[model samples]
Structures are given as C-alpha cells and as structure tokens.
Target chain A: MSYELYYWTGIQGRGEFVRLALEDARAAYTDVAREEGDDVMSAWLDGEHEGALPFAPPFLKSGRLVIAQVANILHYLGPRHGQVPDSEAKRIYAHQLQLTITDLVVEAHDVHHPVGAGAYYEDQKTEARRRAKEFRESRIPKFLQYFEKALERGGGRHALREFSYVDLSLFQVMSGLDYAFPKAMSRHDVPLLRALAKRVAERPNVAGYLASDRRLPHSENGIFRHYPELDA
Target chain B: MSYELYYWTGIQGRGEFVRLALEDARAAYTDVAREEGDDVMSAWLDGEHEGALPFAPPFLKSGRLVIAQVANILHYLGPRHGQVPDSEAKRIYAHQLQLTITDLVVEAHDVHHPVGAGAYYEDQKTEARRRAKEFRESRIPKFLQYFEKALERGGGRHALREFSYVDLSLFQVMSGLDYAFPKAMSRHDVPLLRALAKRVAERPNVAGYLASDRRLPHSENGIFRHYPELDA
Candidate 1:
C-alpha cells in the first residue's frame, strides 16, 4: 500500500524532509492535506484518526500504522526505502544523526518564534533579535562544526558514508538555512555541507523533485523563514 | 555487558529519563559522568568518542554501540528491557509517545531559557516571563490534554496500555512538572497523569531508586526549574 503523509499544504516546513525521502526513493505516497484541505490535518490532530494520535503535524500513515515526528517518520522510511543501512548499528547511528538534525531544526524555527510558539513573531521581535544573534553567531557555527566533523569522520560523503535519509535531511536543512540566512552561512566555512547539498540535489529523483511543481517554496509561515534583519 | 550512561552529575535533567528506564528494568549500568566528572561528557561532545558523537549529554553506550537523544536512547532501551511491546507497530507507537514527551521537556526547558541557551536566566528574565506565561497558559494544557486523551484511549493505565518506557519517561516528566509548576499542574486537572505518576513511583525498582542516593533532586539548573513567578 502507498504511504499517506499529513502536513500543512503551503510551505515546505518539516514535511519537506519526509517529502525528500519519499521522492528520492520514488515511493508512492499522497500529500493528504495538500490534496484535501487543512481540516484533514486538523481532524487528525483532534484525535479523529484511528491509531496513534500525533501531537503535531508531518505524520505518516502506512497501511494500519501511523507515525509522527520528522525524524521518527524518516527512521521508519530509511530502511524500507533502502535509504539507510541494513545493519542495526548503522541504523541506530543514522537515527542519532537525524535527532541532531531535529535539534537544529527546532533552533532554526525558534530564531523567529523565540518567546513562544503561541505568540506572533511581531510580538516577540525583540526577543527574536537576541535569539537570532546567538543562533547566527554561536549556535549555527557549533552545529555546523559538529555536522562537518561528522562528515569528516564519515569520509565527507553522507552522514554515514552511504546515501542514507540523514543525507537527504542534511541537504534539506542546509538548503533551508541558506535560504533563511544567506549572510550567516558562508560557503567557505561549511564546505562539506554545501557540497553535500549540491550533490544530493543533483541526484536523479531528488533533482527532478526539486525542479518539479511538487516542491514548495519557503515562506514566512514555515520553519525556515528569511527575515532580512534576523540574518547576519 | 552493562550499559554506560553519560550525563551531568548535578541535577536530574534529561538524563533522568534514561535513568528511570534503567532503574525500572533493573538493568546494570554505570552513571559515568556522575562517577567520573563533567570532563567525560565534554570529551564525548568534542568528538573524543570512538563511535557516534552526541550533540549533548545523556547518551548511552552498550558494548560497541553508542546512542544519543533522550527519545532515541529510550527507543533503543524499550525493546531491550522489554519495556516496549515486541510488535514493530506497537514499538513505533511507544516511540511516538516518547518523542512527544521529549517535545514537552524541550518546552519546559525553554520556559527558563527562552531567549538563548547560552544566556543565563537572569539575562533573559523578561523573555522568560513571556515564554513561561504562554507555556503555563496554553502549552501545558494542550500537552496534558493530549496525554490525557492518549491515556483515555489506552485504557488509562500506561501510555500503551502496557507498562512501556513511555510510561517511565512520562512519569519522570510529570514529576518534574509537579516540582517545576506546582500551581499550573493541579491534581483535579490532570487526574489520569497524576494517577499514572503515582503508580509509576510505587513500582518496586522505581521506588527503591527514588529513595536511593542515585536519584538526584530537582535543581534550578535542570529542565524543570521552579521559578515562583514563572509558575503562575
């Protein structure tokens, strides 16, 4: 059976990570919210689903099972789509890397919504400036350094030396960050990550998907919003 | 071989979630950072470890494999300790619940450090107040309601009807929240979660561990910090 993904229809956001994997593997899946409406995603969140209820969106349904959380969904997809290694040890390692990416994603999202998720960005602009400063100066460098080191350790190819879902995620995150913070992310500094993003985009299916109408553009409503003043 | 857990020695922070599972299963493991020093954790984060490098603390090392991220570590431990169901679908459900708990933990932490992780609470007190307000008013109720609904669906016993690592982590999170937000979390409001926490604490191994010196007290440094002004 084909997988069914539920997420917001407008922006890439977290759902893009799952979309990249599905597209790369050429897996058959439906973007439920996009085809249907926002009510479908809200209905699931309101416990209208039969199985496990997700706390948030970007959840995947496969046959009888439903899974949420971007990293968790990717973990389930990785092995099934041959995106991750078969060895248990390597699989777990890939998960660790994916979890780190999740952390980075949260921080990226917080750059705009620093005070609280419930509050509007305009209300928290002062706090956002402070948070974004720290994110751009320290957090970005630290996280990029960690990934760069991991790439160095993994022979500077993929997150695990093989084309795993982690690489796809890394590519997506790097692309988002580049779009979000064009000034902060220097090509000279994050050479390995930049190269990986380029290579992943060049992949047959991934490239096709990127150029296709199926790919959504980043927006202020999404996680990686490009606010000029917030960028260094 | 015994598992080795590395985390901060002081407060029962993120590491406590892992500790609860280990203690509940009566698994043999060493609190390496507590016995050794913070240098051990720092060294690992600095990529001094042989295998996967954790972005932060509370990573587990079992024989040749090392795993990080609280939810990921618990996901690995759940099946190994029989805390999760053997079925793949149920196991993934347990993980989805655990990841939700992780989200709550991060939100709880952000209540204190809303502006920046690098900045002190005093430095971000204004932002903290705003963040804490939203957390206490909206986020707490939403998360508790979700868990309450899950409990209702799972027959009000454990997160999955059976005693899984999700229960252990949920117990830890509820306990921390009680200590952190005595005003926000009332017995009348979250009866199911309150009962679950009570039942979890009454477990033989868990009770013994809580009363033992191995159980660390909640401090200002941990995720769930009790700032009087922030609570109400």
Candidate 2:
C-alpha cells in the first residue's frame, strides 16, 4: 500500500523525523504536501477523512488511516516499516525515545521563538538570549546525557544500535545544534554524539537521502537557526 | 502482567495524564515513585531494570518493559485498557490529540516558567507576564479552537463521540488553564473544553479518582498555579 505523508511543503520541520524512519526503512510513501496544488494537509485537518482526525500535520495515511503527531506517526509505523522492535514493550520504549527527542525539538524551537510564536525572533531577542543560554548550558547537556545513556544501553555511540528512528532524529539534533550554536556544540564533550552522527550519516539510505534533492537545507525558517548571539 | 508506573510523588504533573487513563480502565499498576519514596524519581529515571531503560519518569513498567514519555505510554496502554480507539488510524489520531495536550501542558508550565526550568517561577515572574499574556490571548484560543473543531467533527460536545485518552487530557488541560488563568478561561470561548472537563469529572472512575486520595490537588508547587499576579 502507498502511504501518504501530510506536512508543510518546504521546510523539513517535524516532518523530517517521520521521513528519516520511512527512508531508513525503505517504506514506499508519498510526501503529500510537496505534491502539486493538492492542499491535502489542510484537507486532512479539515476533516476530509473518516475515523479519528489529527489535531495537526506530520500525519500519515495508510489506506483509510490518518495518523498524526511525529512520535505517534512513527509509533504507528514502527513495526510495519521495519524501523523498530516488534514486541509491545519494545514498541512503547521506541516511542518513548522519540517523544523525548520531540521535547528537545520544542526546546530548540523556543531558542528562537522564546517570547511567543506570533512575535518575531527579533522581537524576542532578549528572552531568546536568556532561554538560549539556559538551553545551551543546562538542557542540551541534560538531554544529551540521557541520549548518551540510551545509546550506552542500546549499544553505545549508535543510539539504539542498528540505527533506529530516534538515532536519525538525534543526528539531526546534533546537526541543528552545530549549525545554530557552532561555538557551544564545538566546545561540548559530545564525542559520543559526534560519533553517532557520523555513523548515521554513513548509513546508505540516509546518506543517499541527504545527498538527494528531497533533503532540505538548514534555514532560518525552520526550528533550528544560525543566530550567532543565541550561540555560546 | 503487572504494570509499574514511574512518576514523581506529591504532584500529578504530566504523569497524571497517564494515571487517569490507567485508573479509568481499572488497570492494575504500582506507583513506583510513591512506593520507593518521592526522591526515587531520580533512580527510576536511572533505569532500575534490565534490557530497555527509561530516560525519565512518568514511565510505565509492564512485566519487563519500561516505557517513558506520557503520551507514548498512554498510547501504548489506551487501547488494551479500553480507554482509546482500537484501530491504528484512530489510535494515532488519539495519540496526536494527546501530544497536543502535552504541548499545552508544557506551555502551561512555561506560563509560569518561560525563563527556564532551572529558574523558579518567582525569579521569572516578569518574563512570565509577557508569556502568560501571549498564552491567554493567542495560544489558548488557538488550541481551544482546535478542540472545538474536533468536537464538532466528533458530533459535538465530547471530542470523539466516546471518551478517548485525549479527552482525559482535555479535562486536565481545562483544569490546568482554570488554575493558571481563571479570568482568561472564564472569559474564553472554551465551551467544548469546559464541557469535556465536566464529562471527564463525572466519569465513574475519574470522579472516584478525583475524590479519592489517589488524585493530587493543584497547588503552587505544580504546573498550574493560582498565582493571582499571573492571572488576568
């Protein structure tokens, strides 16, 4: 069956997390938002489908199904796409890891949009600086430590070994941090993270996707941005 | 199999979302943190099991399985426990709604903590005014609108015909907003949400839980605080 993914057209945003798992699993799916003049994302949220509807995008459609939330979408597709463990317990564990990655993603977004989403990043620069410092100094390390321990247990450096969905997302996390806070991340004791990123990059499917046209470049438009002041 | 729940003692926090679902389903589980003493939250985060480990609390342990992330845990248990949809599509939609509720929870916490988690609400009161105003003005209506539409789609009143996991979370969100911004929620167009809270409260299990000692009350020590200054 052809799976349809609904998300914004241009930026990777949260959709990239879902994309990584699908690409890594070699799942056959169409990126619906990028399709020509479809307006499918809005349609999906506008209640075109039956059963339960998603509150927002990065949702998936498999036949008659419409699934949403980045982690939830991945959780729904984990076993089917060959990206996670089969048992009920391991499945929940994989989703738990993805949700934590999602939390970090929100923190990353708030580094730029601290005061409010309606207010421009420039308008909230002061708050962003304060939030960014806290993010860089405290949260990043705390979250990374957890990921490191997760990696340590899952088989070290590879983060859930065999390169799961969370690993790909973590790779993006390091990539975004490096782009947004080059100085701080460069100074961080992230040898394990760096190694894992390198491994994720070397994965044939991901390497191909990164080199291909489908992969979007890091931009000021997305959650992670290159703001020199926010960086340490 | 026995389900073991790991969350902080004293306050419900994010764990209460899962706790409500578990209780409503009458699922048997141990509140690990309360059992081992409140400070045991840290050790629980440290992974007190073999195989898979949780990065933080508000996790669930079923048999040898350890799961983290409140939304993920609830999504994992909701169906089997009869608190959620049975289909994959419906399941993901329920999860998406729950994740959005989790977002609101984080946002509500940040209403008091826009500065940083490392800083106290007292230290960040000034910044919180700016954040809380935005939350009340923009975020509340925006999220409440989404819930309103979901209710409309589900045939009005309840957000999914029968109560789902997100409906339980919706009750908590309503409860939280009421505590955080009494005047704002009181004046807002959150009729569906307010109604959902009443419905969830009247649920035999939920009402019983809320009345029982098992339910934690809202206080200044938790996410939704009745800071008179913070309120409208």
Winning candidate number (TM-score): 1
Kindly give the stretch of ten consecutive residues in candidate 1 chain B with the minimal lDDT sum: B185-194
**Candidate 1 residue lDDT tens string, A31-76:** 9999998788887888876889899989999999999988899999
Residue pairs with colliding backbones in model 2 are none
Worst 10 residues of 1 chain A by lDDT: A185-194
lDDT of 2 by residue, A114-172 (tens): 76788888888888889999999999888878888888877775556554677788888
Q: Each candidate: how many clashes?
A: 0, 0
CAPRI tier of model 2: medium
Task: For residues B23-85, write the lDDT of model 2, one tens digit per residue.
Answer: 888888888778887676666667555756676667787766677788878777887877776
Position A92, candidate 1: lDDT: 90
What value does DockQ give for candidate 1? 0.87
Which residue pairs of candidate 1 clash?
A: none
DockQ of each: 0.87, 0.72
Lowest-scoring 10 consecutive residues by lDDT in candidate 2 chain B? Answer: B43-52
